[model samples]
Target: MISKIYTIIKGTGKYIPHLRVKNEDFLNNTFYDTYGKKGEKSNQEITEKFEEITTITERRHVSKDLVTSDIAFFAAEDAIISSKIDKEKLDYIIVAHNFGDVKHDNRKSDLVPSLAARVKHKLKIQNPNCIAYDLPFGCPGWLQATIQADYYIKSGDAKQILVIGADVLSRISDPHDRDSMLYADGAGAVILEGKESDTPIGILAHTTRSDTYQFSEMLYMDTSFNPDSEHKDALFLKMNGRKLYQYALTTVPQAIQACLEKSKTPLSEIKKVLIHQANGKMDDAILKRLYALYDIKELPKDIMPMTISWLGNSSVATVPTLLDLILKDELKPHKINAGDSIVFASVGAGMNINAMVYKM
Candidate 1:
């Protein structure tokens, strides 16, 4: 008889950078519009507009001395400690990040040594048997990694795995671009262990898709922001907020529904919907649409937990960090219990959308 191996989220951890950047901090800086000319909008006007649209009051940025891998190690160590799992026992370490230790000011990235390998080294895992790699799937990267971990566990190929999502998008953000207000730096991680279970108690189902045809160009970074400079150092992140908003409203709800269908779990049984913290309003729209698909008129107030107001958008790190905070009871309005159905969803840069259904 084939024994069923379940991938259980044994513990969670997160690290938010020490530098807290509030909206008012941008008031003194001059910004440029899409054109090369200085922006006509005043600093107050820009900050107010950004806050009104995204509902982001502040975000955390990594200090100049630290990098993405540093924060990832911190979060990973915490996860290992909380999980009570031995460092030498880790079977695999998967890291989700867009830029590997890129400087916030330079937009340069180092891919020579994989970020996951660096994390493993920093944690001082003497186990040469531990496999490590990096995954770059935009903002949905972390959830996607979890789905992969589930596969490894069910296949009995691994006993324990460390999944981490860390990003320093702030370094690639263009201060002149309004989207800069929405970017931040942080890392979140979870330790998943394979355990024998008769009943289904872990990741149930998942779906990941890309809409590169219509939305790939909606969010991107390039050096073309400065028409006057051909130098490679001018790269910065930018986004078509309107296009992303519409894309999330139309596609994210359907993605969640599809994921739920695969899990064979009823909508009413879901205790919480942890979504990527890209924009507060966009997330609410996604939630409402999800409810509409279920033919439920009223959206539950606490069903979808949000941290964008404080954390901003850390790209792939948002959902995991939010999940960690909720698990630790840092977020009062949200909680997860055994026998609960939880849905995780995210949409971001690649114009990618993914969802996973997990039963606890």
Candidate 2:
């Protein structure tokens, strides 16, 4: 019998911030338009309308005492303990994030040592050969890191790899911008190991694209919309929400189509789609468009389990965190069984979009 190495998930874990932020909490925020004008609508009207569109009733934010690296280490520890794998034997510690460790008081991104190195240190790994790195390709960083890990495992250079996605978006969000309510904080990690098999199982095929020429600034950072603020230099996460929604709807489905064609997996076999929880409405449109590519009108029920309504957008952490929740039976009625094919995808800053198909 012939055997081929395949990348498979050994264990998964997530750190969902205990701090739950409800939509009503933002009713007192003084939101402003892009032109520095105060919001015209009443705060109640604004919050209600925002919830109607984004379907986000609540989100999570890290505690005041914690930073990005701390949550990354927590999630990584959960994955290690769940897998019962030797932390010292890890081949790579890949952390995906945009802003580094952001402090509540300072609000400045700290990337001196790289979040991966920080996590490796906090984990107390002693292996000198275990490579640590960071991938900052916007929100798709975690999935992209997994794609890179697959390459090393396939080449026989690595047998075990730890990939984490985390971000403290609340620290970087502008309270004056309505989009601030859409951001959150959390971390999720997974351990990937190479297993010999006769057929493809994990990470069957994936595709990625960057549309920086015209769409790079769809989501960016800028000073607070409040012109009177004392901190003029502090940067906050900003977005052209309409343009970003359109851009995602235009491109994400195409990438998923390319992945499906590459894997040659029929649409009917895809049991689930774990996508970055950027926006609930936008995600619904993406799923519909994906099915439309195959010329199918009706969509499957519960095919895409979402935490965005409650978890908000934690950038890189969304997909991996959602994956962990389902893997642990915390997300009910959505389960992955052996041989079930699933699609994972995301779209975010860098104007980037990516998709991967995995068979469990």
Candidate 3:
């Protein structure tokens, strides 16, 4: 039998910020609705409801001095160490983020140097052949970057690629909006490498879709709801939470099902559904609908492991960070054995959705 080259995750790493902001932390702030009016409900009531729906009780925030690229570099370093590979051997470094680097005091986005370039410089990688770049594909950015790396590896153009996702949503979050409580800061990284094998062992299949026509503005940046705030000129990340949740419910499951069918893998073989940790309720609904696709009702226990209760939503960092936790045995009772199959999926801004089917 002829050998085939496949892209497989060689190693993974994550950086969870030290500053833990709890639900009570938002109780003192005055929140405003999307309509720019003061929140009708009391801050206490709003906080409790938000926690109940999103299941995010506490989230991590980066140190006042650390920026997005700083955390990205840290995650990359951890991944490199975990992989035990020479930094010079990497053929590509793709950093996925949205707001670049925004400082605490000044909420301006600085992307001139490109976060990938900054991370490469910080890594002290002198190889000119190791191309580095950035990808800002909403929350699915990191998974999308991994897909890009898979193409390069399969094409024999890249043997090793590092994909990093880091976001400091706290700085870009609108403090006056209840959604701000869902935003967190964290970074995760994974190194994908080409492996020759007689049978497929990794990256079996993948699918992605962009629904920009009708849902282009579901998630965007705008002036804060608090018009009188000091950072009025700066754009804060905003979302039509209800609409985005609806879109994910309608499309994300289909995308994952398509990927599974493309891989010719049966539903029974999928051991895990590692999806983006956006909203806990939304994820739960999406999974139920996914099973509804096959006319199944009862969902498997522990098919999905979530960290949002403590980690919050870190945009592109969510899925990879969750993967790292399970891989390192930090996430309890969740383990990936030699033959277990898994699915990775995410949906976010750009109204984009993607899914990848992999085998251990």
Give the worst 10-residue stretch by lDDT in candidate 2.
223-232
**Model 3 lDDT per residue over 38-105, tens place:** 97899889989998999999999999999999999999999999999999999999999999999998
Model 2 C-alpha lDDT per residue in residues 1-360, reported as the tens digit of each score: 589899999999999999999999998899888889998899899889989999999999999999999999999999999899999999999999999999999988999899999999999998999999999999999999999999999999999999999999999999999999999999999999999998888989999999999999988889999998777999998899999998899899999989988999988999999999999999999999989988999999999999999999999999999999998999998898889999999998988899999999
Q: Mind giving the per-residue lDDT tens digits that candidate 1 earns over 56-133?
A: 999999989888999999999989988998889999999999988886445578876999999999999989989999
lDDT score for residue 322 of model 1: 93
- What's the CA error at residue 250 for candidate 2, in Å? 1.2
Ranking by lDDT: 3, 2, 1
In terms of lDDT, which candidate is stronger, 1 or 3? 3
What is the C-alpha RMSD, rounded to one decimal, of candidate 1? 1.8
Cα RMSD, model 3: 0.7
